[model samples]
Target: MKKRLVVAITGASGAVYGVRMLQVLSQLDDWESHLVISSSGALTALHELTMRRPEIEALADVVHNVRDIGASIASGSFQCDGMVIAPCSMRTLAAVAHGLADNLITRAADVMLKERRRLVLLARETPLNLAHLRNMTAVTELGAIVAPPMPAFYNLPGTIDDIVNHTVGRTLDLFNVEHAGLLQRWQGLKKTAALVKESVSREHLISI
Candidate 1:
């Protein structure tokens, strides 16, 4: 049977991360995605990314409203492989850390933690205060992986899409997902130079 992956998007600034994750998951055959979005997430997505709410909703196999606390995902028996909160807002993070299942996203995350399943949170914020640190520490202590969407300069990304894909690729890596051609891995500059030189030399030889 295919593995179920729960994806939650809360009220965070990086809405593109959530959208890219859904797009990436859509390409995988062995993974089924159940999506949930907070109401504020919808607003942020529209205002920031100019994405229609329906466009985001259509990306998932099943979309649950954040208000739906009694959804199937709330229970630990849902048999999910993992849960990922892309662009996890501080509000949602606090709820998850405190085990306050006021919404479906928090409830699902709580279930993941209780069941000892993988819970990856892509926390998006800067200049985090003590409260943010405490919540992150609390969740990490409970076996949740807190991954901030920090950009990697090593990838030498040239475009906005490159940065987004790299972040999403790293996020998928936390789930042990096999993704190729998404982001370039770090290779020694000498080796890369040699490879490029070899290619140029071959072309020169062909021209001769």
Candidate 2:
């Protein structure tokens, strides 16, 4: 059987993260992607990506209605490998933290928690308040990974795509998803420093 992953996109700022994730998952023949997009998520994607809902939905193998409480993913018996909420909005995070299960997105997340499956939340917010921090802490205590998509300077990304890909790649890593060539792996700093020194030395010789 193919490995199944539930990808939920909420009304977060970085809707592109979820889109990129689905795009990547579509490449893996052995993996199946089940997608759920909240109403706000669709609106956000339309605004940010300038893509219609159908275009975004086309990237996934399966799409579930946000209001469908009885979807396969909403139940623990559906047997999914894991779930990821890319660019997880604070509202969704709170819902998951509180075990709201008010909608299919939160309901599916609740199932993951109850089933002890991997649950990764790409929490997107900055200058967080106490409530946000508490909700993050609460979810962590419940066995969910709260991964914020902070950019890495070590990669020396030259473009926005590089930075976004790096974050997506890291999120995939939490699920042990194989996304080769998505992001540059960090070699040790000593090795990188030596390379930099070598380039600088060559520059000095040329200038002399």
Candidate 3:
């Protein structure tokens, strides 16, 4: 059977993660995407991506209204494989951590947690305050993975899209979904001697 994954886009800096997620998922035959975009999410997409509303909506298999708390994805019985909130805002993080289901994005995430399903949040803030850390810790304690999309310079990404796709691919790894061939896995370092030297250096530093 095809797996269903709910994807939410929130008001955060990395709108591209959400957009790239939809674009990648759209090409996969084994998975279906349910999308929810917050009011602020839409505004951010326009400002950050300069993408039209229709263009954004066109990428998802099913688009949900942020105000529709009664949507199918809002229920625990919806039987989706998992949910991902790409570029998750700290506000949304606090709400989900506190069990606030005022909006569909938060509501669906709440359901994912209650049902013991995988819920990945690409938290998009730096210089985190205590509240943000507390919220993240709270959600993590409840089985939600707070996966901030920190860039991997190790991948040697050539462009912004490469960086985004690499992060998206690893995020999708949680659901066991095969990415659209964009994920670059880390093989053993070309110079094993370098790894040995680095490990020895760290050990010596600790000893010192």
* Maximum-lDDT candidate: 2
What tens digits encode model 3's per-residue C-alpha lDDT throughout 149-170? 9989887889988888889999
TM-score of each: 0.90, 0.93, 0.91
Q: Which is superior by TM-score, 2 or 3?
A: 2
Using lDDT, rank the candidates from best to worst.
2, 3, 1
| Candidate 1 vs candidate 2, TM-score winner | 2
The better-scoring model by TM-score among 1 and 3 is: 3
lDDT of each: 0.91, 0.95, 0.92
Q: Model 1, residue 62: what's the lDDT? A: 86
What would the per-residue lDDT of candidate 2 be over residues 69-169, giving only the tens digit for each residue? 99999989898889999889999999999999999999999999999999999999998999999999999999999999899988999999999999999
lDDT of 1 by residue, 95-167 (tens): 9999998889999999999999999999988999999999999999999999999999877899999999999
Off by over 4 Å in 1: 189-208
Which ten residues in a row are the worst by lDDT in model 3?
179-188
Ten contiguous residues minimizing lDDT sum, candidate 1: 184-193
How many Å off is the CA of 91 in candidate 3?
Answer: 0.3
For model 2 the TM-score comes to 0.93
CA displacement after TM-score superposition, residue 206 of candidate 1 (Å): 34
In order of TM-score, best first, we have: 2, 3, 1
